[model samples]
Target chain A: MTTEFATRHLRRIRLVLWGVVTAVLLATGGALMMRSYLLPPTSEGISVEVATIGETDIRSEFTLMDHTGRAVTEADFTGRWQLVFFGFTHCPDICPTTLAYMASVLDLLGPDAERVVPLFITVDPARDTVPVMAEYVAAFHPRLVGLTGTEAQVAEAARNFRIWYERMDDENAPDGHMMAHAGHMYLMRPDGRFDDVFQEQDQSPQKMAGQVLARIQESQDVK
Target chain B: MRVLIVAALAVMLPLAAHAEVVVTDPWARASILASRPGAAYVTAESDEDDRLIGASTPIADRVMIHAIETDANGIGRMVHRKTLDLPAGEAVDFAPGGMHLMLMGLSEKLVEGTTFPLTLHFEAAGEVTVNVPVLGVAASRLDEGSK
Candidate 1:
């Protein structure tokens, strides 16, 4: 009888131990899941997935003529985000390629593209006249606006954007000479602030469209 | 079956050996207006050492090889080149913001989606004609859809 009673006591203890072990395991698992799902991400031990370009300040002042011969400034682009690229119509490679990429990006954005302006500002203002700008932009997206101005106006606009351009007077050049300009595509916020710059290799329609949409959402969140 | 296979291989080998330098993905940006200069790009690879001496296209009055470079001050500039070196087993990609063919005095405006003929002259390959497809003005690389 005493042995039987001792055996029953041992079994009870074993059951309690198992119950405690199970409870502890469940608590630990719950804590880990909570830490993963509920807690904010810690920066020190984590690798950032997407790296973005640092934002910079851009000059918001300048008056230039749009493709339609209309005078335009930052005010003209206000209330809508602007995707600006600096190139001329004569630019056979970089300009057209970048514009096409931007066109695809805008197309992907669909209805969201209505809130954005794609601007093609000619660094070769001497040759990119109003009519030329109009015709050139027409070949790309319908929403693309080609901007040009007099030499001084173009210089001022380029200076404001911190972009560079120069005339090449090579005698052996088939075009007699050509204009060489910076090939960066700038994403300007609705407030005309410099948001990001898209380099050649990192540029894709889908990637840029996502970045633009994210930036817009970020700005809205800030407000 | 062995003899048939060997005969086919022999016939193919001679044709491939004669055409050492191959030009592919030839394309040009559409010109907004006729008589304006345009640029063309191509991927040229060689099984033997060769040099891209020049290029010709009837679409334009004259074609010249050019290289666009960035100066120390960060300003971009175009340099005229008479020839471009193409080493054996190496692929030379003529891309934007780099080496390209300048098509000057365009006889007609190159419209997007249209294809034109361009002839590339190589020191070893002699002359290789390619169909240069016209793409959008701001297109950088030839995507599958564009090709």
Candidate 2:
């Protein structure tokens, strides 16, 4: 009887230990879930936010001429998707490459490309006049629009877009003048609001088209 | 089990295709434009070798290497040179407004989404072939990595 009683006591102890172990495991799992769910941005660590620049809050005012010297304003970008690339006509490579990519993107998108307007905003207004821009842009895609303004207006537009441009002089330059301009593209929504921004590097026509298609779809769903 | 096998194959195929270059941070490439002369660009490794030798395209007349020269005043001038050497893996870049390959005249225009065959003759690595997929004509400035 004493042996049986001892055996029962040991069984009860073992059962209690097992129950405690299971409860601890469950509690640990629950705490981990809670921690992950409440994961907050650390103050010391590098923090990044999506669309954190909030550049859309600012609006760029441009008193510029289109490719044909037609007076254009920020309102021209409204009611249609516009892709604005900042550069100069003297930029033999980047400017042309970007326009060509946009042309391809337009072609790939087919009819939908019509709703998407492509604009080349020149930082070098001295060299890239309305006519020169028209011709330079025509070499890439006919549908692409080119915009140029007074240095002041151009600078204002660039500032709104958070782009930088400066003129560098070259004593030995064949023309004795130079313009080192910023290179990037911004996507303005149909309402003239800044929607997306693309880098100067690491982009393909397929990727661009894919992004446009996806964004268009997403926007449609939201509407 | 079957779905898992197929998914593995799908991932492996493209990786095998791009086994040549990882392009982790970023690397630049341009499509061999069709219907005209050819051009080439590089996504350079800034910290590594910065030397380039010769660039060749199967569709081009000849691969002429060139880089842009910007004087103190910020004027950019294109100077054609024979070799751009990247020493000890120092990254030499060939992006717009800086160092680049002036792909003289092309046999055709470089259209987007098309991959062009380019042979790069590096000073150290001998010869490496890169499939340059063209981006856009006006999109030429290539800055890689987080600046």
Per lDDT, the best of the predicted structures is 1
Instruction: Report how far residue A29 has shifted in candidate 1, in Å.
Output: 82
Encode model 1's per-residue lDDT on A1-223: one tens digit a residue. Answer: 9999999999999999999999999999999965554332322111111112224556545789999999998898899988888877666656666777878888989788999999988766767889989987888889999999886887787777777554443333233335454367788888878888885557567887888899888999999
Taken over the whole model, the C-alpha lDDT of each candidate is 0.75, 0.61
Model 2 spans with C-alpha error above 4 angstroms: A1-60, A171-182, B1-84, B88-98, B101-147
Q: Candidate 2 lDDT, tens digit per residue, A29-128?
A: 9988655433332211111111112455545457788989899887866777888788765444555566777777888887788888888887767666
Q: List the residue pairs that clash in candidate 1.
A: A95-B138, A96-B137, A96-B138, A96-B139, A97-B138, A97-B139, A97-B140, A98-B138
lDDT of 2 by residue, B1-147 (tens): 999999999988765443122121122334322222234566544233434567778666666565656557444445557776555434455655455554544666566556677777654445567777665444444332112
After superposition, candidate 1 runs with Cα above 4 Å error? A1-56, A170-182, B1-19, B68-78, B112-114, B135-140
Question: Which one wins on DockQ?
Answer: 1
Candidate 1 lDDT by residue in tens digits, B1-147: 999999999988756547478888888877767656788889999988889888898888778887765667555556567898999889999887677888877888888899999999987678999999988666677884375
